[model samples]
Target: MAQLRQWATTLGFSQIGVADVDLSSAEPGLMAWLARGFHGEMRYMASHGLKRARPAELVPGTVRVITARMDYLPASVAAEGWQAVEWARLQRPDAAAVSMYARGRDYHKVLRARLQKLADQLAALIGPLGYRVFTDSAPVLEVELASRSGVGWRGKHTLLLSREAGSTFFLGEIYVDVPLPLTEPVTAHCGACRSCMDMCPTQAIVGERQVDARRCISYLTIEHDGPIPAELRPLMGNRIYGCDDCQLACPWNKFAQRARVPDFDVRPALNDPTLLQLWRWDEATFLRLTEGSPIRRIGHARWQRNIAVAMGNALAAWRDRVLTADEASLRAQMVQALQAWLAAPTVTGEAQAQVAEHVHWALAQQHAPQ
Candidate 1:
């Protein structure tokens, strides 16, 4: 077990644990959240039904599951400068705020390959194991399993939290038939800290360990399809990809560790990019830049839709401040991008009409009485 821990650490994993397949305790909460329609348009969460809690039922012969957590803070993030950098991004209305996690190579690819390698190493010792690896895949109760296995206690925000690593990490699981010894669960350490709840822009974290994903900015920007809710659009701030307010506000994150792998480093296009600059990218450019990114999964249409909201947020921010030539240049570039989008042959009927309306509104704002 000590050897496994050392090996996992060398592979960039912060911690590893073994959890039993019996997750009967979490079934009720999962059902209740689904019943409340908190999942919004993500029907798969409901579609999977109770199978998410019953690992053996989801995957036959799974007696034990090995869970791993890998810290994702970029190596480039200065120790004392993390919060300042994130706050600065939030203030720049023209800048698109992608969740720190998604700015890197798709974590799904990175974690899965490494996890399979770990499983292969185990097989070399024990010979012929029935195992399957998953990282954020559907039909998995990843966080619940990780917490139960002592990777960390569940935070008030409901994400698995570690004292040494906080919640800024990726989780991967290996379901196997072997009955590996289980790890001791950790006690919750949230105490009086409600910062994650208080800082949630959309009030998505309704209570301790409860999040209404329907109202989460991360859900709205990424998982959701169709029109974004009007009420929530303004609350999304400048986050064009995913929101990290809850995570950023947590005091425990002061202990968040940096990623050892270069694969988790920020891509230039996603780092400190202006809303107008990203909005200017055509479908081809979007595809080329986001080829290996999780953002690419949403495709170009949703990407533009997200950027349009940020552009709207930027316009709203500029309205409150005295404008400068640089700001005016940004607004002009936004207008030009909207016009280009309007002319695009592949723009969805719904998105095309929405873009046209936003363009007209933006143009009217330019000429409105000050």
Candidate 2:
């Protein structure tokens, strides 16, 4: 385990743990969450069924799972109280506030490659090892495994939280045939704290440790690939990529660690960009700018749809307030951008469906009350 820890540190992993394969206890909660439709449009969550909880079923020879944590808070973020900078960005109606996680290279690729290498290392140490690596790509119960393996306890926001690392990290797993010593599980620390729920603009944290994805700004902007719900649009504010209100509001994040690897560093394009700046990127530019970034997966249409919602929110934010000369100029720019898109019925030729209604809603917001 000590050798594995040293190897993990060299591979840019923050922490490591080993969990037993008997996750039968978590199956009930998984079914309950799915029954309540909490998974939203993430159909794959239901498709895999009990295979998610049964590591032995997912990989026949698996006896124990190796859980890994990789901190993603970019180094460029202010070392002290970076959450304040994000909150300030949220207040700026025109800034395109992307989730800190997606600001850099896609985590899926980074974690998967390293996990495979780690698995290979283990095989070298113990001949003919059977194992499979997975991150968010599979239906494996990541948070459950991590928590069980002492990676961290699951917070009220449904994210793994650690006294040492906070919630600003990504999780990966390697199911192995080797029966390694189990790591000690950590106790939950979220006693009498509802800051994440209160901070949720759309009230998506419906219950203790349960989130309704339909109402979540992060889910709406990223996972759901349709028109923005009218009521939730304004609440989304300027978060055009993914939302971070829940994580930002958590007190433990003050201890959020910076990424040790350059792969998680923030891209220059995403460093405090305005909605207008991102809105100006057409399909080609969008693809170019987000080449290796996770934002590219949303495609140009969904990207347009999300920004349009933020732009409408920006317009509504100042609908009742007086504007300075510069503010008026910015307002005109926003109005003109919305109008230009409205002029063309097809927002994007490649869009599966046009976001015309969203633009209309955005223009209509010009007359809405504060």
What's the TM-score of every candidate structure? Answer: 0.95, 0.97
Candidate 2 lDDT tens digits, 253-285 = 999999989998989999899999998887889
Worst 10 residues of 2 by lDDT: 345-354
TM-score of predicted structure 1: 0.95
RMSD of 1: 2.0
The candidate maximizing lDDT is: 2
Cα-based lDDT for every prediction: 0.86, 0.90
Q: What lDDT score is found at residue 187 in candidate 1? A: 92
Lowest-scoring 10 consecutive residues by lDDT in candidate 1?
360-369
